[model samples]
Target chain A: MKRVPLSPLRAILARQLRLLRAERGWSQERLAAEAGLNRTYLSAVERSEQNISIDNLYRIAQALDVSAARLLTDL
Target chain B: MKRVPLSPLRAILARQLRLLRAERGWSQERLAAEAGLNRTYLSAVERSEQNISIDNLYRIAQALDVSAARLLTDL
Candidate 1:
């Protein structure tokens, strides 16, 4: 299988998500549980190795206690 | 083909995108062109009939002159 390159926007999002999670002092496992997602998948998303679905993003934003817009702002 | 259900967040995004487009007096064709996407695809996205990719969402946000966060805010 061929690997697709990660889009720059996703790179920014991955970085931003990491910062937000760190700011909240939450581990990847904790955040994934709160967001009702698999920890491994969340790890891939944070590493910009996934094309995260919008629904998953929404759930993660809700778990992070921020509006989705705020989560992706400037990214 | 079987249809996938539209997520609530995507429904909100569709409504917001329509409102924003209307406010700007731009047609789907125009927005699609500006966002560098297919008009048909954009139409489906606006109708909440497609699971829009985050990359395309980012492009559309750029064309809308809003942060991706802003676009998904309140959605």
Candidate 2:
């Protein structure tokens, strides 16, 4: 298989997620429950360890009361 | 495995990709090549059959000469 290149975007997204969650004072568990996601999975996403799907991104954004695109902007 | 809910955003993204490629008059093979992805995989994404990861989304957006967030906006 051809290897995928390293992407700075993932780290950027991870930082954005953590920042957003911190701004709301919500723990990973709270955000995960609100987004109907597993807390562990959400933690992985926040750490940029998961190559997150768009559906999950949408769910997380909804739970955070933000646009899906907003999570990815300015990065 | 736990079930993941269906999300309309995937369909929206698929439609956006198709529309963008059409606007450029590029075939799936062409777009796939430009995005450094397999043609069949890219086709699945266009059909909303794949829950595409953000890294691939970034690659596709780069290949299309648009912002990564642009692909998810106005949907």
Candidate 3:
């Protein structure tokens, strides 16, 4: 089988993170701090330049007070 | 805040892959073929030994005839 990429999932997650953070009126730095992630990494995620791990997704979801599943919805 | 991991997302995606494949009565090999991925990687994903990429998830979801968001829900 041919290789398939996984960046779209990252894009979806990034968009969800951005939306969720904005909904809470928090800056990326604040969200990163809250999610216990590096601000630079968070910025890269928001820009779809990075693929986030499951653990980080959970942390961001938790920091946003939503289920991890919510971040993957409607994308 | 402390560093948070991203394995939970991988776990959730793995579970979703297994559930979706079961619902379709397909083996990991079949799903992997349909998703254009390595059967070994598919097995690893089913066993939670690997983290799937967003592109691969979309392929799997398409192969299973579901939205990518569906894979992330209810976990």
Each candidate's number of clashing pairs is: 1, 0, 11
Tens digit per residue, CA lDDT, model 2, B1-75: 235577667777888898899999999999998889999999999888988999999889988998777788754
A1-75, model 3: which lDDT tens digit per residue? 566655467777777888888888999989989888889998998888876655666787888988877787744
Error of 1 at A17 (Å): 1.6
Candidate 2 lDDT, tens digit per residue, A1-75?
335586556787788899899999999989999898999999988888898988889888888888877888764
Q: What's the lDDT of the predicted structure labeled candidate 3?
A: 0.77
**Regarding lDDT, does 2 or 3 come out ahead?**
2
Error of 3 at B32 (Å): 0.5
Candidate No. with top DockQ: 2
Q: Rank the candidates by DockQ, best first.
A: 2, 3, 1
For model 1 chain A, where is the 10-residue window of minimal lDDT? Answer: A1-10
Docking model 2 quality class:
medium
lDDT of 2 at A71: 88
The residue-by-residue lDDT of candidate 1 on B1-75, one tens digit each, is: 212244567877788899889989999988988888889988888887877768778788878887666667563
TM-score list, all predictions: 0.80, 0.88, 0.81
Best by TM-score: 2
10 residues in a row with least lDDT, candidate 3 chain B: B3-12
Shift of residue A54 alpha carbon in model 1, Å: 1.3
